[model samples]
Target: MIHFFKQDVSHIALPEKFTYPFHYTPHPLCVLATGEVKEYIAGKKEWQEELATGKMFGVLVVQMPQSTDTGYLAAFSGNLAGKNIHSFFVPPVYDLLQPQGFFKIEEEQISAINQRIDELENSASYLKAKERQKVETAKAQATLNQAKAGLKAAKEARELRRQSSLALSEEEQAGLIRESQYQKAEYKRLEKEWKRQVEELEAEVTRFESEIERMKMERKERSAALQERLFEQFRMLNAKGEVKDLCTIFEETVHKLPPGGAGECALPKLLQYAYFHQLKPLAMAEFWWGDSPKNEVRHHGYYYPSCKGKCEPILQHMLQGLEVDDNPLLDNLHKDTKLEIVFEDEWLLVVNKPAGMLSVPGKADEVDSVYHHLKKLYPNATGPMIVHRLDMATSGLLLVAKTKEVHQHLQEQFEKRSIRKRYVALLDGSLSDIEKTGRISLPLCLNPLDRPRQMVSEEYGKEAITDYQIISVSNGHTRIAFFPLTGRTHQLRMHAAHPKGLGCPIAGDELYGKKAGRLYLHAEYIEFRHPIYGDIICIQKEAEF
Candidate 1:
């Protein structure tokens, strides 16, 4: 259910007409609401009346089950299903004290007032009894004094009679006895009054005994609440439960601190918890959670700096299957081409690829390509590695390493620009200078709209270099020997298609230059240090163009 009951409409105001292009938009107070409303749009009839009368009401539109902040119902609308709902309506702000958070607080105050009234009534009765006991004490003291005086007189009379030595009268002796009895009775009454006073004091103490117990319990509960708040703050900072030494810290330090009227105790615990969690050092006593209160990581001075920026995701995806053992190319190569094992050794294998075949499986499904074909050809190889890639449309020499150690050695050579690779490609342009070579240095990056295509970018691009020499010009096309200094995706196509360079696209490159049935570019040569032989090995293939 959507909880929209606590919200108020006065806090939300509609913009002046013509300020907003849209007739209605989401209301801001949807977060503080209680009732669920399905398909409730903003700008309702009630909202228009409230806005016109310059009054606000608590209103919200909520999604059911989730109570999501999907939209908000406001008090303004131009029309309803069939009537102009905004025409005959007036907002009543003061008359309507709809049940809200303030209502709850007022109810709590009323309850407290009623409790205070009961306490006052009980206190008044107790005070009246105390006053009555004081009056009784005064009366009892006066009576006891009178009785003592009378007893003194009777004792004197009896002494006089004994001195006279004449036969003492029985009636006089009896009188003395009676006076003695009266004194005794008065003393008893006084004792009774004193006892009554003691009983009344005890009764009064019993009345307040529960108050003392309540105060003690309240202190205990406040202490527990303070600890809980601290623990919650600690969890927020650490992003996990049970920080180290936290329980001991609360036991030794938090418990000893005074709770200033129950509420102040949570502050110290919160501060100390932040200190222990490394969000703020113990030396810093004060800290703010910041405008974004949910971000404890920021408050604790932690940051995650982006490494590769936009390219990071793409690179991560490329490396996902880099370490996997499966090689799909072996199982899905085109039927027209078959792999030819050129040379084999303990740690390496060389293969000759046919034209119209990929060096590795495409990212799409369907493998059985050259890399997997090599793996299947030598099932005992530790980890088949492609030292270089031959474009699917171009084919020639391809190298693979059997072990990771050998693969790294060859990869490092390629990275350091120590390995030499040469390719021959037929271009659509004729060359005026024979055996003339030139270098093309340009930055390369992927085209934004068509990411599969590469583009030349002077800004925010990687530097690429290529060298080319004219081989033969015949049939309005020039065959050239190409050497690349930097390996980049589609670097050769870019170099050959440049206006100042060959000015002719690779023969079969439909993406760059004149389209043909097949690409003429071939992997003609590769030279690198042998992993086991400790010798400089150079492999070459005849020019395909």
Candidate 2:
């Protein structure tokens, strides 16, 4: 059974509702740890320099037993030096910093090899070889130019002979033609020689490059050998002294390659420390303690989930012997709630989607979706029933087509920008009148390492535009209406939270902002042309707060 520690009955206030610990405010213990980290940073001159440049620090709250009372210990995630060294916090699940570790030795050797490769590229022999090729190319060009000149002169002579038909004999004209032929042959000969010389030079350059690549490959093999040894050494021990290395754990469980940043989170650190010290594991929470990263949204003090790509597999193996709580976020809160069908016809159907229900089935276990329910209700429904989708946390109007023909027609309308959609949202911060109404044009794409989470990426993202107007502002929150022009994933959420756009996340946005009861984003209005009736169809729904 999962275990939770009982807080001391001393009038110490705790959150009345259970905050999803994975992505929530720092626990009091974690806050105290942050204070300690702050003091530690202030005392060290080196840490001050890193702090000035901006860095994200985190603290994990764990429970330990004491004679008088249950005590709490706060473990910082990673190191303050940003070098990821072993610290007061739990050692990394994989000790990449072990003295004389294969990883360390190979990493240094690789650096030296890279330096040698760079030097080879800039060496006198390499430079001279390149220079020789250049000179050969120039000589080839000069020879080709001379041949072309001779050919041109011969052509001119032939033209002069043809024009002087009355002055020159047939033999003389034939002789001129012969001379032109000879010049053409000489040009061909020179061209062939130039080609041969260039090919030989290219072959020489290829040989030189091949030799360099071979050397680099040899060094890389050495590095790979060391990495294999290091991976073998990455073993973790639990409180019961049962040990499992990373390679075995990953191979047996995830059956995939370990992702970057694996074994580099607060959970691994906290768990390792708890097991080593024989502390009884209790409630745990991790919270950000410093500046937000430029590329990602990380509010200072906001709790975040351990990254799924990296930590999911590792945590799965590490938490095998521990009694852990089921992730509250995965619970389907809207399982009992039915899809509210607002409008339906022979050709199409429209429904008012709830905040927590998915537009369609996702994972195999996630069979509760509007599309799945609708398919069961209308078994004859053809093609894709879901014409468009709203985010799982976003509530409101959704379009559904009953037939393939109807779906195609509606999809065409969407592609042509003929369908209109308006959303209502509550922003976390107030906006001035000038900032109240404007178009937010930001590009968005998925954060590759973190799936499903979208970020504003200028270079790699698709265009996402939203025209917004503030409806009302009270108690530091702005109620805004959004008219989206482009249908990109998470366009409205990212636009609302991006610094260049509104600079405030929609109220209750868990991924882009702090978590609340529900995401305030609601699809309040939609308009499109009916496929069969040929009349314009409009739908609107009010948000339930």
Candidate 3:
């Protein structure tokens, strides 16, 4: 059985139930473990050295049944020598240090093969061959140029002879003609020879390229086979002594092969250790500790949910008989609200959208959206009525086109940036005097591991700009008005949350800030020219909050 770390937690309030593994606030045990790990790392000289390199470390709080108390185990996602070897933490999912392991051998062999291929590509003989081809091409071009010059000279000579034919003998004229014919024949012969040489040189280069391609394909095949062997060795076992390889588990559950970083999480390591030791699983949580990655938002000492893309499928199989909470985010919350139409015309309609309703039908079958509701209300609507979309948590004025032509026109306006919009949000914290009015220029991209979550990442993100001014400030919160210059997924939420932008997330943003009753963002105003009417139309709706 796993041993629990002894600490005075008499005042700490333990959660009565486990957190929904998909998303929830971290349990008290997990938070305590995070604090302990932070303290431990700060005191260690080796850990300080490792932290300087920006390595990510994670901790998992688990309950061991045999110990009659909840304990925590820590592990790095990839590797950290000082942390991994610590007795207080669980062992790695796979120890890569074993010198005679098949993984190590396959890795070394593949590395050697890649090195050999690189050497062959840059060898002296290969470079010399390329230079020789270049020299031959230059010589052929020179010969072609000479042939053209000779042809031109022969034509000029023939023309002069023809003009002087009356003053010259027939023999001289015939000789001149013969010389011209000879030059033409020589030019044709030179052209043919040049073509032949060029073709031969091209064929030689093709052969060299083909040989290199063949070598690469051969190496790829070997590497693929080795990788398959490595994956097959990653077989996991359950408490019942039944075993299944990681590939089979993912395929049977998610109907696809396991993706990269599938079995490299803290949960897999902790669960595997529990199964082997016959310890009943009680609760588990994972937290991020270290520098945030360049492309993802991860603050040190923050608790994060397990990734959906990589871990969900694996955990579905691993936690076969264990009871878990249904994901609350998947529930349809738009059933009660009716579509509020603000304005209607022959060509278009503008409606007030409610928060918690989808802009369109999502992947889930039970989802109720503004588009689907409009289809029911206007059964004879000619085209896709929803011209644009607001985030599910944002309430606002939405434009709808009745005909395909009107839809196209409005879409064109949006693309041209002629349509104007304004949003209102209550931020969690106050802004300084200079920050009362400003624009935020930050790039954003989706966090693949956690769906719908946007992070500030300049390297791989799209440009998202937001203009804002303080509307009011009271009770440790500031109500701000926003003008979005560019549209991107979760642009406002991320901009509000990013430290470089506002340094405070919009209130009730579960992904970036603390969770509340609902997100405090509302699209309050919109203005655009009518497609058929040629008159400008403006609409406004007040937020219920």
Q: How badly does each model clash, as a count of residue pairs?
A: 26, 0, 0
Error in Å for residue 70 of model 3: 2.7
Model 2 compared with the native: what TM-score? 0.83
Stretches > 4 Å off in candidate 3: 1-19, 49-61, 66-68, 81-86, 163-181, 184-215, 237-242, 249-257, 338-352, 372-382, 401-408, 427-450, 453-464, 469-479, 497-505, 542-545
The lDDT, on a scale of 0 to 1, for candidate 2 is 0.73
Better of 1 and 2 by TM-score: 2
TM-score per prediction, in order, is: 0.39, 0.83, 0.81
> lDDT rank, highest first?
3, 2, 1
Q: Residue 201's C-alpha lDDT in candidate 3? A: 78
Candidate 1 regions exceeding 4 Å error are 1-333, 433-435
- When summed lDDT is taken over every stretch of 10 residues in candidate 2, the lowest stretch is 1-10
lDDT of 3: 0.75
lDDT of 2 at 66: 61
Best by lDDT: 3
- Per-residue lDDT tens digits for candidate 2, residues 395-422, read 9999999999999999999999999999
Off by over 4 Å in 2: 1-49, 52-69, 73-78, 82-88, 94-101, 123-139, 145-185, 192-208, 237-242, 252-255, 364-367
Q: Estimate candidate 2's RMSD in Å.
A: 4.7
Per-residue lDDT for 447 in model 3?
Answer: 72
